[model samples]
Target: MDYFSQSIKQAIRTVPDWPKPGVTFRDITTVLQNKTAFRKLIDAFVHRYHDQHIDAIAAVDARGFIIGSALAYELNASLVLIRKKGKLPFDTLVEDYELEYGTASVELHKDALKPGDKVVLVDDLIATGGTMLAASRLIRRIGAEIVEVAAMIDLPDLGGSDKLRAEGLTVYTVCSFEGE
Candidate 1:
């Protein structure tokens, strides 16, 4: 791995059988705990996006907010949040998607984007791709164009990145873990 990749990998903590059996979860709290590592993580993203004509940063619910908010501040772009169903207070655009176990929904406010707006979707990680895909659809349904989907870590073995690419969406990640 490259130096940056190695650093990011070292910053993450791997937990075994989290929330289920045989699941190796890539926990990013360690990265957040380290000021230098967290800055490095945001700096990598900011460097790539600062020069781009990005109108907004839309992040998936929960962890996505952590990275997305910081990135929005760095890039001076508007921040939009995609949250679980009924989480938003105002009128929302909802998209239902299949999770590994069953169905779930996410919501984005109706006024989050304008037509033809260029947006970058942010998340902590991409696993099965369902959540990211749903976030993309929500952004698109509001008439914004997705420039790319950005994540801190990607589990290629899960096929999430490939699935997003198959739909012609660009996926960018700072580091990747090969297997579960």
Candidate 2:
């Protein structure tokens, strides 16, 4: 990994057997707690997307909102939130995806996007790629185009990023962990 990537990797905390046995969870709370590292994390994304004509940022529920909002503000783009089915109050478009364990669905407000709006999907990490894939479908259902999917960390060994790339998406992550 390069210097910045290494920095990001160093800032992350790894917890073994989290949420389930044999599952190593990479946590970003460390990065969020460190001001310099947080800035570095956001700057890495802003630097690459500042010049890109990205109309909006559609972040996955929760953590994605954290980075996505900051990025949208910096890039002068709008923000779209892809949330859990009942979390949204307005009419929504829903998309279902398979998780490593089971299934889940995400929703986007129906009026969130205009036809042909260019969007970048954001999240804290890419694991099984199901959430991002569901978010992508939610965007497409609203007639918006996804420019790419961006995340802070990627568990490449889990094959999430590879699955997204196989579907023709450009996936960007500051750093990646080899094993899950």
Candidate 3:
């Protein structure tokens, strides 16, 4: 593994259960709190697509907002937020995605990205891939081209990358829980 990638894997904290019972939440807060690790992560993302023509970054809601905004600044690209329904203040394009137990929705401003804008979608982690898929649909609705789907970590056992790959979305992660 690369230096920064290895550091990120070390920074991930394995919480047995979070937000519910029996679900292990691989928290990234530890990495965020460590200045060196966090900078390495930011640099990792910047390094991957530094030469790509990115017009903006479509970052998922809540946790995604944390690094998404900073990433956009690092790349000097526009920031487009993919928020939960009723959260966006302007006219929006929303999508409902299915989860194992239920369904939830996400919304993006109608003007978040202009037609033909090259965008990179980012989020903190991918567990089931529902939220990111929903965000992708919303971005496509507004006519933005998704150059890549970037995540801080990928939980392959949960089928995150497989599901996204089925839809032809290329996924990149700084860390993986595939064998963990």
Candidate 4:
């Protein structure tokens, strides 16, 4: 990792066996709580996409909203929310993806993006590649082009990043945990 990535990675807190046995969660709340770290985190993203001509950020639900909102402001782009099914009130497009245990769906307002809009999909982390993939599909269904998929942390051992790449989507991450 580069120096900036190292700094951001250090700000993350890891919880062992979270929500299940043998599972580790890389939490970004610690980074969000630290003013300096949070600034650096946002700055890193701004520097990367400032010149990309991005029209909007299609962020996965919850945690992704935090990063995407700040990034959208910095990039002077719109923010589109991808939420859990039924969370959106407007007409929506839904995509279902498989989790380790079951299937879950994500939704985006049908009119969230215009055709040909350039978008970056943001998320807190990439573990299984399901959520981001579903969000990307949702964006495409609206005829928007996905510039890339961005995340703060990647658990490569789970093959999320690799799976995304195999689907022809560019994946960018500040840092990665190889073995979880």
Off by over 4 Å in 4: none
lDDT of 3 by residue, 40-109 (tens): 9989999987888899999998888887898899889999999999998889898999988899999999
lDDT of 2 by residue, 139-163 (tens): 8878888899999999888889999
In TM-score terms, candidate 3 sits at 0.96
Pick out the ten consecutive residues of candidate 1 with the lowest summed lDDT.
1-10
Q: Kindly give the number of clashing pairs for every candidate.
A: 0, 0, 0, 0
What is the lDDT of every predicted structure here?
0.93, 0.91, 0.90, 0.93
- Each candidate: RMSD to true structure? 1.0, 1.1, 1.1, 0.9
Task: State the lDDT of candidate 4 residue by residue for 67-117, as single tens digits.
Answer: 999999999999999999989998999999999789999999999999999
Question: Which pairs of residues collide in candidate 4?
Answer: none
TM-score per prediction, in order, is: 0.97, 0.96, 0.96, 0.97
Off by over 4 Å in 2: none
Error of 2 at 141 (Å): 1.6
Candidate 2 positional error at 178, Å: 1.2
Off by over 4 Å in 1: none
Ranked candidates (lDDT, high to low) = 4, 1, 2, 3
**Candidate 4: TM-score?**
0.97
Alpha carbon deviation, residue 64, candidate 2 (Å):
0.5
Candidate 1 lDDT tens digits, 27-146: 999999999899989998998898899999998889999999999998999999999999999999999999768899999999999999999999999998999998998998888999
Which model, 1 or 2, shows the larger TM-score?
A: 1
